[model samples]
Target chain A: MADTEKKKVIKPIKNFSMEEYISSGHRACQGCAEVLAVRHVLKAIGPDMIMAMATGCMEIISSPYPLTSWNIPWIHVAFENAAAVASGVESGLKALRRKGRIPNKDVTIVAMGGDGGTTDIGFQALSGMIERGHKVIYVCVDNEAYMNTGIQRSSSTPIGATTTTSPTGKLEPEGKSTWKKDMVAIAAAHGIPYTATACPTFFTDLQKKIQKAKEVNGPSYIHILSVCPTGWRVPPNKAIEYGQLAVDTGVFPLYEVENGAWKLNRKPKELKPVSDYFKGQGRYRHLDERFTQQIQDKVTERWNKLVELCSEKPEK
Target chain B: MTKPMEQISWQEIEAGGVITEPGNASCYHTGTWRSQKPKYDENACIRCWRCYVMCPDAVISPDLEKNIFVWNYDYCKGCGICAYECPAKAIVMEED
Candidate 1:
């Protein structure tokens, strides 16, 4: 036994709670990083909380006709009203505490939505929630399209990515003509206390942001880039690797905004070319050299702007 | 195990369609969907916990007492993420 123990070397691991808020047996696709992000987020939030989830892939996969994978209090609302429902839930909890019906304790309220539910349908409600200064954490799990609805394109879909609605046909070489919506910028525009972008490939960073969001007094928003193997047409095993590539390529720079101050999480010495990231996925398979160059130019421009923002100190 | 979907009746439905039991979906085994399964080599494992942390199905659990990881194949959809992410290459995806 001693010799066997010596043979196996275990590396030191960061402290992560083993308690699972999202259980197994979920019907999510084999390599669904969206659910993985949810698991890590919930773990960071701990058990004392309520989740208001919009109708999307996560909602459908976790809950079927008569069963659910959620271990904590979770409510499913309409696609456009997850933020609205979350604010309502927060108010109700406050009311109960004031009335002494429930013990006065901090119960974190979190609202979750997909790219389509958040950037398109639920944009107004999200804006209202942030503007109202509700003590809620709104998370947008972006898989780049309306994945639950047969891979339809949404405003959050990246340029040159093919979706059911944004097809690369004889007339249109590029799939989506427009760039992906900058959701973190929109959330920061509301002057929320905290806003950050995270990916499941960096679990520790994702959890750290969630912890920060939970501790903040006012509204906070976290936009997570969930790599979808099914929609993106990548092998299941490559989901996490693709997420890492996304960050390395500077296509999605992981950064945070706190009280109008910007801070970048991971800054690579030199960004990998956009082609290195795009070539692995089937969505960008039809991209010609010109389109890839266009994407590279846009990504570099955005990354430079983010670097500039992070370097500047917030004016008092 | 949960009752089959065909056998469940309207009378058994919970109020407001709320599932009374949390995490009751565990009864529905998803292992059937997997065409391949992971074979773990305990001796080769370094126990870095990478596979445990990245498993989407929550089927990988670290046995703290033994200081090793265990896989619950019942619910593992066998996406091969664990095998692919393993730094030591201790896990291999094999035909189910």
Candidate 2:
């Protein structure tokens, strides 16, 4: 009980304002993690920002025809052009400020998309945006699969998870046979000022990362691990729990690379077994014990490598 | 969820999804989707506030004056993550 009391004292819950930019009543699921992530992200970035959202869950659910959930200036383009559109918007604003058409260029530009749009279809646009040095924040809500498009497998999809494109049936028992694409590393590789991985389970951390990304001068990337109950075959109520398990298990460690310096934000004292994270999700139900062991080994290996990277001196 | 499209004038709609008026989506009540509602028991609560951090809907607002957590039922879909994550065993999910 004393330990529990200490825990309560350590994490004093701050009363964040009830005021929301992403208003209630769009078409997200009962426990949609991505929508929740977006809600917090908007809260962090505040109302003085404009957004370019890709054609995915966030766009479809938030802005459907006449009814819209956004309280900010939000633009929706094709799935692959969110970054490009954001770049154009940033340039347009700059041009407007230069010509004295606008009083000031104070609004922050944000490009948001699902993992499928960010890692697969929109990779080229994202690379171009980073390389060209646009003052914008790109948010990748990684729910592991293309959940909006009926749970199709994407490059960000983790290995051993069953999806529509990577079905585990009579022939294929392991589901998706490939590892998740490390988008944060790729973003860091572009010599960006900021790149971080965040999760909805840790709301404060996620909010802080978004705020930091907003403050950075050049292109910044925030890769958020959003849980999908519908696609992952977990109870809708288990969305936040699964996200916590992901972090605690070291499967998706929360960290940031600020100017090529790696930092591990939350390192669990004892990493939870990867099987504990997988057993609840139906996507990994078909996985045999041996396959689960393999996944465990892989997770441990990745975690060790990340720890080593964090320890080394950052390259100049 | 269906609104009369014909009733809306062309000038009323923005060209893109740019919401000129802020917080207009608050008008649409989405709490009707909840099956199980979370009931907070203050007596059993230790004020750990884990529920405040875990709630996806941001429906839990802390009332420092009252020393209790307030649930905004209008927006809360009652996913019960708050109840499940409550270390104090204070919040319980009840039939809506």
Compare the candidates by lDDT and give the number of the best one.
1
In the range A1-316, model 2's lDDT, one tens digit per residue, is 7885544332344634456777776768877888889988988888789899999988887765676777788888999999999999999999999999998848999999999899999999999999999999999999999898799999999999999999998777899998999999999999999999999889889998988998899999999999988899999878988999999999999999998899999999999998999987999999899999999999999999999999889766
Consecutive 10-residue window with the lowest summed lDDT within model 1 chain A: A6-15
Name the best candidate (by TM-score). 1
Q: Give the local distance difference test score of model 2.
A: 0.86
Quality class of the docking in candidate 1, CAPRI style: medium
Model 2: residues with Cα > 4 Å off, grouped in runs: A1-18, B1-20, B47-49, B62-67
Per-residue lDDT tens digits for candidate 1, residues A109-215, read: 99999999999999999999999999999999999999987999999999999999999998888998998899999999989999999999999999999999999
Alpha carbon lDDT at B20, candidate 1: 81
User: Local distance difference test, per candidate?
Assistant: 0.93, 0.86
Q: At residue B83, give the lDDT of candidate 1.
A: 96
Clashes of each: 0, 0
Instruction: Pull out the clashing pairs in model 2.
Output: none
Give the per-residue Cα lDDT of candidate 1 at A95. 90
DockQ of each: 0.71, 0.47
